[model samples]
Target: MAEKLESIELALFERLIDVGKLLERRADRATREHTGIKYTQYEVLIRLRNAGGEIRMTELANKLVSTPSALTYQVSQLEKAALVERVVAPGDDRGVLARITPAGRQLLREVSQAQNDMIRDAAVAPLDREQVEAAYAALGALQRHLRGEETGGILPDQAPPEDTH
Candidate 1:
């Protein structure tokens, strides 16, 4: 006789989709509050900040997973805000090196802190330490995988245990 699956397991796919949407929603809400910058812009800014110096337009585009034209547009906006600036690359007159300005650093710091605070507060809510740690670990790993990194690989049995009792 086939055992009937519980409601939770029966709706596994739906639950996965719901969780994904909820995560995105939370991220969107937080980013909007910190700055009007979208996640894409934030990512570009973060990359420049991480570089600790200027980056060529092509490289920035690659890091942002965007095209040259799109990167140019975002860079233009950031330039207007004095968040980023462009300069000539040494030995390459045609190359434009984009760098984050002091004001941009300040803005990034503020936004980063706010995002962190939000996550820290949430970690203290509803979920226990183990759940929070697992979530954080999973998110980081997934992010890396999506970026085309060489992953350590996930196993079928290593998935989060479903509540069935």
Candidate 2:
């Protein structure tokens, strides 16, 4: 049983790495051709949008799987495009928050739809919806486990964080 479990773990790790590489390649190609923004930037916009348009820079960085400096660079670019603005956090002058502008929301809507369509066409269309749901559930459980939470239940307030990798 121990050997079998190790084999399963190794295979899962290999498949996950392969999937990450393939998705990154495909997403980069699609975004370059259609959105004019990198996949990671779009992910940042989505994260901001989902957080009700603004969130602390550190919080956003955590959600984005990015470093503060890297996120700062991305946010700077977005700010120049008028897609996002950085504001000193109220009451905490030292903290910064990234706010998605109306333009950012509009762009997110357009690009998100296109990106979803592209992903569905290229990936989801090949999978049974039930299979996809099963995968989502299993991955969510794994995510919670990896985060050091107990297995089997995710608290209402402990919903999985968005993966912007």
Candidate 3:
């Protein structure tokens, strides 16, 4: 029983990693073909758009699962392309905010349409609605678990907080 359980656990974990890799590869290819921007850049634009068109740079980095320096570089590149702008945070000389511009919003609309078409046609066409819902539930639970949410399975990454002495 123990060996069988361990085998199932390993298989599930490995398959999860593979699924992520495959999805990323497909997203990158789709972005390049449809939007001419890297997948990560489109993701940043979407994040900014969702955050009311502007957010603090540190917050953006956290949302993007990226480092501050890396996000700064990406934002600088986007600024050069006239897609985004950075302003010093109000009354905070050390803080910066990244705002998507008109051009950025337009780009997002185009890219989002393209991505929607691709996902609808290429990704979701074959899946039954119930299958898709189940997959989403499983993945969402995993995400919550990793973030230490009470709703999930409390995986290793969700270790209990240490009490201050």
Q: Give the worst 10-residue stretch by lDDT in candidate 2.
A: 150-159
lDDT at 139, model 3: 80
The candidate scoring highest on TM-score is 2
Candidate 3 lDDT, tens digit per residue, 37-60? 777887777777766678899989
How many Å off is the CA of 62 in candidate 3?
1.0
Show where candidate 3 strays beyond 4 Å.
1-5, 148-165
TM-score for candidate 2, residues paired by index? 0.83
Write down the lDDT of every candidate, Cα atoms only: 0.71, 0.77, 0.75
TM accuracy, model 1: 0.62
User: In terms of lDDT, which candidate is strongest?
Assistant: 2
* lDDT tens digits by residue: candidate 2, 126-158: 899998888778777777777643232322234
Better of 1 and 2 by lDDT: 2
Residue pairs in steric clash, candidate 1? none
**TM agreement with the true structure for every prediction:** 0.62, 0.83, 0.80
Candidate 3: RMSD to truth: 9.5
Report lDDT (Cα) of residue 131, candidate 2: 88
